[model samples]
Target: MTKKMTWNEMSPSQQTGVLVTGSIQLALAATAWIDLAKRPAERVNGPKALWAAIIGINFVGPIAWFIWGRRR
Candidate 1:
């Protein structure tokens, strides 16, 4: 098994990359959730509850929701 690197062990660039990626993930999920909440069931392609769950699936989920889950 390989040793896991902690935040302190990460290089500055790696740390920045991680932070940026994490922020993007958080923003995407938040946006998807907000859109899902404000959008009606009829407007969404699937159940809002299911989309809400899918939104938690990191990058792919939110992107998929924006591209396919919404009726528009």
Candidate 2:
């Protein structure tokens, strides 16, 4: 079986990478949420409340919104 390394056991670079990835995810989610909030109800493909909940979901939620929620 493979040994699992705890956070304290990870190398500095590995930890940095994890932190950076997490930060990016947060940023993307925030941006998507803000954009959704600023959009008028008529411009969104779905209901504003539904999009708000969807955007709260981790990485995939924001991506889905950008891809499917916004009207062309």
Candidate 3:
């Protein structure tokens, strides 16, 4: 899995799968973001201000993960 992979090596479905999964996660975070006030107390205390950070870090995590943390 460490080997670098070109887009061509991934099947059409595989490519779509990665995109759809990432998109879903992005959408969920964006949607959940709207209701920070409604956020249950637990998340507030833990992910708390962390979750409530401006959209900047919220997105940066995913991008960083994709670039530096990808299995390959």
Candidate 4:
């Protein structure tokens, strides 16, 4: 079985990397959510409510919204 390391057990570099990655994901999700909110309902490919639900899904959700939610 693999052991899990707590935050205190992680190296500084590892902790920094984790923080950076978490920040990026948060930014991506936030940007996607804001864009989804600001976009007019008629211009979106589907219902705004549906897209809102999707944007809350985490990294994959926001990426999917950018890839498929917006109308070209």
Q: If scored against the real structure, what TM-score would every candidate get?
A: 0.95, 0.84, 0.50, 0.88
Candidate 4: tens digits of C-alpha lDDT, residues 11-41: 9999999999999889988999899989998
Strongest candidate by lDDT: 1
* lDDT of all predictions: 0.95, 0.91, 0.57, 0.91
Per-candidate RMSD, Å? 0.7, 1.9, 10.1, 1.2
TM-score of 4: 0.88
Count the clashes in each prediction. Answer: 0, 0, 1, 0
Candidate 4: residue 51 Cα off by (Å): 1.2
Give the worst 10-residue stretch by lDDT in candidate 1: 46-55
Instruction: Give the best candidate by TM-score.
Output: 1
Ranking under lDDT, best-scoring first?
1, 4, 2, 3
Q: Residue 36: error of model 1 in Å? A: 0.5
- What's the true lDDT of residue 50 in model 2? 93
**For residues 1-72, could you state the per-residue lDDT of candidate 2 as single tens digits?**
999989999999999999999998899889998999888889899798998898888899999999999986
